[model samples]
Target: MTVRDLSALFLDSTDRPLPRAARELASAGVPVFPVAPRDKVPLIRHGRGFRDATTNLAQVDTWWRRFPQANIGVPTGAASGLVVVDVDVHGTNGYDALNRADRAGLIAGWEFLVRSPTGGLHLYYPAEPGAEQRSWQAGNAGIDFRGDGGYIVAPPSLRVIDGETVPYRITELATEPARPLDAGRLRGFLDPPRPPRRLPTQMRGQGRTGPMKLANWLGGESTDRNRKLFWASCVLAEEGVPYRDALEAMLTVEQRDFGSREIARTVASGYKRIHGDPRLAGKNSASGAGTARAVVDAAPEDRLASARGL
Candidate 1:
């Protein structure tokens, strides 16, 4: 089988701009998952300033061992994959519409895909019902779908061909729909989930309480301003908002002395920027005032002072 056949096996008929070789492969009846060129996949640099790279399962575990002080509630290493989009029917130029559709479909139909340890998500779709297109986009950023029949997004190292692993650029092709593999068999290929490993006693020094333990510090006497700020920060953190923005918004909320309108604005901004909306943070009202006050009263004095600009 040629590369085009390989593309048909892996990609749908929606992705476009197939590379010449990929089209040739597709024409020759080769199955392929046309991935983008090497320089395209984003690379995160390693070293002192950068978050350590965990390209695979082993590296992920090693990073966890070294950063025992870090929280493990979330995956430490990032993984990559592809998202295919049907470009022929939707019109290749209408990428935004295609993206929204793909995102919705993935979220609604395939929640399991979201649980991957890798951060990269691949979108796959058919490339023309008949003719060949060159390339397609997975979504935002620089991710591209390439090949004559269809495209694929994979790590810079891995490549896919007619059931054979070889160094070939991902591109499009034409072929029958891919057969659904047994879910159990696929799971067997994945890294097994392990229990939370404990760090060494030496690594668990004075400052090394787990994330849960440190959260207990939120208890005790705090000002109304501080209390609101704390709750807002907790809400954002729980929702997976980035650290720096969450911190800034929390600070802004506190600095405004917890005025309802000002607090509302700060919360709204955070919701918009982080979680997509302010109301999703839940309604804050006079009903919670007494509870808020009580929480402030129970906070540590030093924490309260810090909250109140002391």
Candidate 2:
């Protein structure tokens, strides 16, 4: 539908944008639930999930009235006639991958699209009526299908990080009513053939992983920010990346222009904790959680301190 067509359905809700947006989406026959304003967490307490989304004007009004600032949530997959091909634009080269997918015609015949606050794209398509589609991951293909048990925060919702706000917007509005997403098209997407095993290249051995881990930390919103840094450091250190290089890469991705060297040192401690130890240094440590914790317990506090630099 055109922007005007969509906008026509929404009554001017200038005083309270979130509540107005929610009501407008519901009025268009899309079931909606309230998310904490400016955040994805549900505002309504109790067992409510996306399954509780309703198009009922009375219920919608009650929800927005109680939590006037609540963000809007729409369940994906077949239930709401939407299957979102999530193109994450963060790490793992999502932007390139999305372009390739589109070139390969993996994405077509749909129009609804939402740009995620975290630099990702949520491509929405209508699902086939009565289709029991569920959410699934497409390996490291950098795309996710948000169907069944998944929800999308509706547009007009702003995601704030580090005092900066990014709003999700619908880039492509459907001209006609969305049809249920096609099964064949979805299968082509969700189940691409696994490639033959190949040995790690030089790039894989000493590339991407360290920077990706660091990016994760920089982009994190965890209260345990210090812990996250420590964790990321260890991962990078294990990859054999030098402390200085790791710091530069992380800072670059995070867009920090300057900071004391301590930030790098603290992050590198994670690397040091792993490399200095005989087990992980030798790469003989068991993979996964057990080994991860052992590495943390071994790191010195001086290295894991959060406020060392800033």
Candidate 3:
């Protein structure tokens, strides 16, 4: 049997015993990536600011609510699979081909699954003579390969469609042929290399300092430009620009290329007429009125400052 065949078996089962699968792969000389069960963890919803799998499972429930409809024509949720690494025996010994560093790199490539706080395991396989390693990391998790007598980990939830039990014999599954990893053909994989040292700029406003502020201001989370505008303002504020002045700068940029001053003035006047009245406070239109006031107030201040500087 080949690595592809083992992959097929792993994919086919939805309820198989993972330990048995690991042993089979080991016996076949195939390396397997394992995932452990995690409870009470949150999964991120793709393309949205919301996270699934919170304490109340609000996020998970929300995901399920939107998932069926969202993925009508596509695959939804997570997928389970394995990765095998092979070595060139003619050129180098199997162990020499993949050392601790190579195993670390493999884990780094699939770190997202671990960072998700989702329960998953990673497995490492030393390259064997006459075998090739396959490099595939995306939408998958890896198993840890450190320490002696360490076994490949598998998820108990993995199973076949008809629910046939897969045995836990590493030898049965490990004997499969290893896939070839060609450096030239796999150049694209190396394109997005990791940076050696993280820059301070990259660290700024990432966690609580950034998204948290915007999430608070918008009542829910701000979307696109709204969030950006808030963050830009924050950055400007950090750079010594007053919060109000930063907002004004953004608005000035919006209005500078207006084709007609008269039209702009007319629109401004209309807004002032409707919003200049105080009666609109504490009403259905109050939020819109406040936003308009913020923009109008900021724009003039920015323009005045720019004029003084000029």
Best by TM-score: 2
**Model 1 worst lDDT window (10 residues):** 107-116
Whole-model lDDT values for every prediction: 0.29, 0.57, 0.28
Give the alpha carbon lDDT tens digit for every residue of 94-181 in model 1: 2333233323222111111110112123323322222223233433222333333222332122333345443312221112233211
For candidate 2, the 10 contiguous residues with the lowest summed lDDT are: 287-296
Model 2: how large is the Cα RMSD against the reference? 20.5
What order do you get sorting by TM-score, best first? 2, 3, 1
State which candidate, 2 or 3, has the greater lDDT: 2
TM-score for candidate 3, residues paired by index: 0.20
Per-residue lDDT of candidate 3, residues 1-310 (tens digit): 4334544444443244334433444444443332222221122324322111122233333443443211100011111123322222232222222332232222122110101112122221223233222233221112212221222223223222244532221111222233222221122222222222422354445653342243233233223322233334434344443333433334443322221232222222222223331332332232222322222133323412332211
TM-score for all predictions?
0.19, 0.54, 0.20
Better of 1 and 2 by lDDT: 2
Segments of candidate 3 deviating more than 4 angstroms: 26-35, 39-179, 183-185, 188-310
Off by over 4 Å in 2: 1-16, 173-310
